[model samples]
Target: MSHTPATARHLLRRPDGDTTPRFSYGADYNPEQWPREVWDEDVRLMREAGVTVVSLGIFSWARLQLAEDVWDFGWLDEVMDLLHAGGIAVDLATATASPPPWLTTAHPEILPVTERGETLWPGARQHWRPTSPVFREYALRLVTTLAERYAEHPALAAWHVNNELGCHNLYDYSDDAARAFRLWLRSRYGTIDALNHAWGTAFWSQRYSGFEEILPPRLAASHPNPTQQLDFKRFSSDALKDHLRAERDLLRRITPDVPVTTNFMVMNEMRGMHYADWASEVDFVSNDHYVLPGPRSLDELSFSANLTGNIAGGRPWFLMEHSTSAVNWQPVNRPKRPGELARDSLLHVAHGADAVCFFQWRQSAAGAEKYHSAMVPHAGADSEVFRSVAGLGRVLRELEPAAGSGRAPARAAILFDWESWWAAEQDSHPSSRLNYKQEALDWYSAFLDLGVRADVVPLGTDLDRYDVVVAPVLHMVPQPLAKELTRWTENGGHLLTTYFSGIVDENDHAWLGGYPGPLRDLLGIRIEEFAPLLDGETAELDDGSTGTLWTDRITVTDTGTEVLASYRTGDRAGGPAVTRRAAGRGTATYVSTRLGPEGLCPLLARTLQAAGVPGDLPESVRGRVELTVRAGADAEFWFLVNRTDEPAELPGVTGEVLAGDAPERGEDGEAGPLVLPPRGVTVLRRAAARG
Candidate 1:
């Protein structure tokens, strides 16, 4: 599949060529779980809640097709007509999320196998293997049937390819996956000799003479080859992507007018699919994010939304699923606070989400996710959860002007690479606790804390767009990437990277000579050995901050290198803890220890100042408020989200109040400071600057 810019997709439904901008609102409507009588009520509440669209028939495979020869559309047809009559559009699903019981029973070979060789059975969702031929045949049949039947339906707004592909069965070691993996390897390496050389198979006598001799990185004694594991991860992600393409192609061929999308899991630790690689395959990107309980929950949410918007190329994307309150799958599902429901939804809007939707319209009464929060909770529409849902709908309707706007580009960015993320945290590394995603998130939080807007962009994004780029734990430094970074630095882009980076090439082979290999000259520093600290160990720096987890013994090789901060206590005391070297008009800085969000603030403040990056908020509201801007041709919409539980005040702010309250005016007719409510989000519209 070729890349399609998300901006080109006709995302929303417009009646009679109406060009009015409006945010799409609703949830995944699972009418199959409820009786026909309840669906009418569901649509009524949806209208009251200002819903313009709903995703239907996502998990209705068994209900839609009871048997191989049987087909049931009477219920679906009535539901579709009901939604269209109720003034709602439908993002109709292909009903291929899971296979029916009949198909799985008939084709047992479609089941996925674990690395230890245990077969995954049907009761759960996504039980089939991505590389299964029989599964694709049956899945494509359902897609084709649905596409042909609803090609011209009035309510059909978009085609949802499949629900969260590779969410559960991403890594399959079955025979089907073995064959697909071999084929993918052949395509990637082109020859068996090339594969052997890349995998470094000569070390373990694991060299293969032919592609057929290879297998999925299944359970092995001691440890599997690092490069083999990395390749398998890549292949598994591609396998799922190929399945997505199959359904997408079929749907487009049958219903070429409608756009197609599948929800991506871009939340915490769900790095199975490289979404940067998958974004171009869909018309518009959609994501399912569930907040993980912690102090960093809000920051992580903002980080993920920022990354998702950039993944969509700054064009508006979809918030396919989130929670109305508490989610069912957590260790202890806690409900949202008084203002969190509306605040959370608006934050996504601030980050360029044109549509806001939840998992299901009504909560399920008899399923694994029965306890999960929905638009209409188990307490019915009269409860607080439903009231909050309706209130959010009104906010979305009021902020309709923000629908198709693009995110205002930031002067700084944090590079997020899926391949580097996969390879950096693999087994047999310096520290088992080295988390790549968390490190990136920490940098994002620091930016937010300092009131600096920094886009969390993918690895291959244009580096020339930003004045400063931060690449944390960028482990895999291929030749081309190394050259690009060097060129970017020479072209006056400040490059700041952390330890454990630039150590390995594309094949996971250590860059010879010394540590931080490919970037040694660019950074003007060298390290002969890594000094990864033990758990609970800490190293004190002269800058009054402490580092943990990892440290490096630095040896400056260039006369231009300046030590920004040095270690005050611990191993290699008085050595450089942070260093910077001038290259062309810009500088390359390096941090040799793990300094978390709070600890990173000081360094970031100084670095950003040197790079001439501007902060968005005033000093008093720096950490208390988060700022995100969405700009159209004429105006910019500023989203001032209060990150703290206490109310925050922003002085000297002037804009048209779009959502949330406006600043109070004095008797003399002068507007006072804009006061943000506790855990609230405020959207302000300002005129765009003209050159």
Candidate 2:
């Protein structure tokens, strides 16, 4: 495997010879809500809280334009000037998301209609139709105006275009949207006959003889087909991409140097927007993460943060939006425990974040997010949240120089594909209860448990660098990807895939042959039929352990494929539940059922051992201390995090960088493991060696 130099991969850097600031700490600030007299106080509070960057003008459209032709910037100008004077960098928003009432009122065509054909009222945001010419004209005007105004401002560090593009699903069935869909189809399918064939329009006497006859698939509940629904999902995603490209192009024209990005809500299954496509145009990725009140939330957020960081290929990204305490959107809004916020923030930075920012700086006086948590509550800066922010600020100020200058070294990678996600959910058969995110999480958890540093890489990534590549639930088998996987396996790279993978294509259309599609040859298994168990039913495995959820009946196609595990009961009792095949100099493993943690642990452990991954730590420090190593120039950095409540001991034979020691480790033959307090993270430097 060839290595890409560290210098070539680093996209963001501070001024030459300048010390990099520890990841920028800040939140979404809206001085627009307060008076000019309050600006100084806000700055003081921000400085006290160690807030260095402010995401400004996110929803300031109403203030930017007061009338159809009349523009207003009096308050905005003063706010920027004050923030700049305070030495706070600004992530200036283009304010294109929520247009002023006058524009929508003047042009009703800009308003989006729902799937039920009801047009949205003016008060709501993200209600504008993407295809409307009026919306395009006004959006461009707003972005260009803001870019030209602040293109050279010293305070502007980055450009944030439209807050959460495609917040609302592309639901328009109107004439304009239909026309645009037709044009997109024409460009993709080229001919009407190919479209008919791919969509399988002949099944319902619904063949489109021409492009004009084609319409976006709208399936009624009783007659829904997976193929049509899948196409609609693809079309909707493309439409949203078109909207983003328009805004991105305009921003690039004005300020090409400033990185432009939009925040993505991770685990959003309904949107169909994949990071693979969006990453092509984005400078770096940002994610809005909100954790529910449960043990699962912590792990879920970690998975998302790592996934986003990996999507950028280890480039520095930001925690674009998170609540300081409680989130108002859920059915039950719960606040984070005293140290949870700080712990999570460091965890993000340890993983890959270059900045830690929250959703809102101040509580909204009114609106849906009125009750959401903030740096300063509605009760003012004397609140507990404010104190926490201030304390965090002091810590950041002291540690920013050392921590900010370092990055993580990951040697493993997990393949993430959007087409597979779409294809899996769109399948007509199998349980509707099957969730893509949870499945991905299950596989990710396996790696996390073993303390393996794995980046959630996109499908087309160069696989030679990774010793093991895990693709869980790869439902769609794009031909190019199948070929790549085959090549990787032949070159001696271990590949692992799970059930319901390789079943469909890019269009969600099933492959002509049997299950597993093109992956069958590589997997060396031919599945005859799959048995999906109901909520309470169970399927037994060959080891006398029971497996629940679902199972598949399979036959080995090649002598190389070995059955690692099998079902223990039912009609297909003793059928293979897990199989492994040797291809060329490498091996491929295929699991025919979803295994719970108990069933999955041993399998994953064995795979890791075979791939030459690191050993398991002593059981005493398993969950308490998390370790990850990232390669750097001439050395490697090992990040040790204590997630438990009490100080814990560390393993011997490693360099120590405890709170007060010099940056060196005493070579003691059997030194006791160092003790780490609750929620603390330590970075230790060591030499890098190839496996």
Q: Model 2, range 351-458, lDDT digits (tens) per residue?
A: 677778887888888887889989888989988888877776665555443343334635556677776776676545687766767777777666666656566777
TM-score of each: 0.98, 0.91
- Once fitted onto the true fold, the runs of candidate 1 whose alpha carbons sit more than 4 angstroms away are 1-9, 13-20
Clashing pairs in 2: 408-630, 409-630, 409-631, 540-568, 650-673
**Any runs in candidate 2 off by more than 4 Å, and if so which?**
1-22, 219-225, 268-271, 398-411, 544-546, 616-619, 643-647, 653-672, 685-691
Best by lDDT: 1
**Candidate 2 lDDT:** 0.73
Per residue, candidate 1 scores C-alpha lDDT tens digits across 437-545 of 9999989999999999999999889989999999999999988899899999989999989989999999999999997998999999999999999999999999998
What is the number of residue pairs that collide in model 1? 0
Task: Give model 1's TM-score versus the native structure.
Answer: 0.98
